[model samples]
Target: MITYRLLHPEILAGLAAAGHGAQVLIADALYPHSTGVPAPAARVHLNLRPGLVAARDVLEVVADTVHIEAAVYMADADGGESEPVREYRGLLGSHRHGGDQEVAWSGLERTDFYAACRRPDVCMLVATGETRPYANLLLRIGVP
Candidate 1:
């Protein structure tokens, strides 16, 4: 009898367990979830098919549940900017906050992003079947 938009049990559990400053990774299909980030933090695979559940879709849901302090996007590994980053920035601009909260977007090097995800503070990872390059995003939860 949940009234919220997000109904996934695992996602809800992870969010509940997570504290402020904890990170949640919403990754693309190409992102290496197995070795890049360790398990036991909880992972929800919404990647039903290619382009089935996009990273943006999951981002929207996660945003609704948590107050995002900052967002990190992967820069092109080939030493250039990524289109996905542009789209992600646009989405962040349109994201609505109920109270006096703000969501900021930040860019990180591809390697740096991978390294950050390895931190022990990351609570969960959602692997979506998005095929777009550099579609991965890391969100830091803010206190309400």
Candidate 2:
């Protein structure tokens, strides 16, 4: 048996195929998984029901498994920090992104967020059952 908490076969396979600089999105229930992202990207649906599986939970496991270089969250419409964004910021607090060692984090505008996630660099999108608004998050994989 695998010792890692990330036991999902599809998740393992998708992450294995992706390399450094490849993006992974832990999307909330409201985020568009199909049309918002590229057609070739791997999709994992953990959204069995509302609040059953949080985007934060997925993010935690993914962070443990991969070296994250960057983090981007969909900004709240009111220009205030949402619950998930706060949690994400705290969780990804220490990661030094890219070759420059900069804190690779951004709160993206609504339309811009969708566009960034749609790029071919995204390898997988994990659709969670989180109910909170503006909880979608994007991450860039770093080198081992």
Candidate 3:
């Protein structure tokens, strides 16, 4: 009965179970889904093949499903953002929160980013087949 594109039952159930400040990761093809997140977290694989079910695709649908307060992505050493980051920025621009009322677009070092993924707060980890490098994204769930 939902109008949104996210129709998967498992994904909907996982999102419904998580609370405010919880995180959801949209992992790329190279991401270590099996070993990265904790066993308690839900790992939903949408990675059918390379270039299919991209991280951005999951992000767009999940955005419609929940209120995202902040989003984080891996940044390069030189401080330049990737195309995927730019694409995600466009998607997050409308949803703002906190005092500044702006969606936090944070950048983390590669190793640190993976470390963040393993946290217990990561309630849902969507494994995508995005082929681009650094296409991973971490979304912080916000209060409704």
Candidate 4:
């Protein structure tokens, strides 16, 4: 039996198919899941209802399931960190890959973030029900 928090078959298959440097986007309810990512990217919809699942919740499980090399957040309009970003940072901080190597962190404007997600390198896109604005996150998968 699978022993980790991430048990979704499609998610596991997608992650298994993705190699290092592949990106995964865990987006909020407000995100445009259908068109946000490229057509080749695998889609996993966890947005059961309004606030049924959260971007942070998906991030937590994904983080634990794979080795994350970097993290990118959608910056607030004012270029300041949003509340969801702060919460995500805390969660990412608790997970590590390749010993003490720190996960590279960065941010981009809303448009730029969407552009990044549309890139071919993104292997999977997860749509969550998080209601917080600017709660989108893009994670880079790393080697185990």
Instruction: Name the best candidate (by lDDT).
Output: 4
Question: For residues 1-144, what per-residue lDDT tens digits would candidate 2 score against the true structure?
Answer: 899899999989989998989999899999887887899999999999999699888888888788888888888998666889999888777554454564478888889999999999999999999999999998999975
RMSD of each: 2.0, 2.0, 1.8, 0.9
Clashes of each: 0, 0, 0, 0
Report the error of model 3 at residue 142, Å: 0.2
Report the C-alpha lDDT of model 1 over 1-144, residue by residue, as the tens digit: 999999999999999888888889999999887866766667889999999798888888887788788888887877555877677677767564446655777778888989988888888999999999988888888876
Worst 10 residues of 2 by lDDT: 94-103
Among all candidates shown, the one with the greatest TM-score: 4
User: What lDDT is reached at residue 87 by model 1?
Assistant: 71
Clashing pairs in 4: none
Model 3 CA lDDT for position 122: 96
TM-scores, in order shown? Answer: 0.89, 0.92, 0.92, 0.96
lDDT of 3 by residue, 24-135 (tens): 9999999998988888999999999999998888888898888888898987666667888889999878766543466778998889999999998999899999988888
Models ranked on TM-score? 4, 3, 2, 1
- The C-alpha lDDT values of all candidates are 0.83, 0.87, 0.87, 0.92
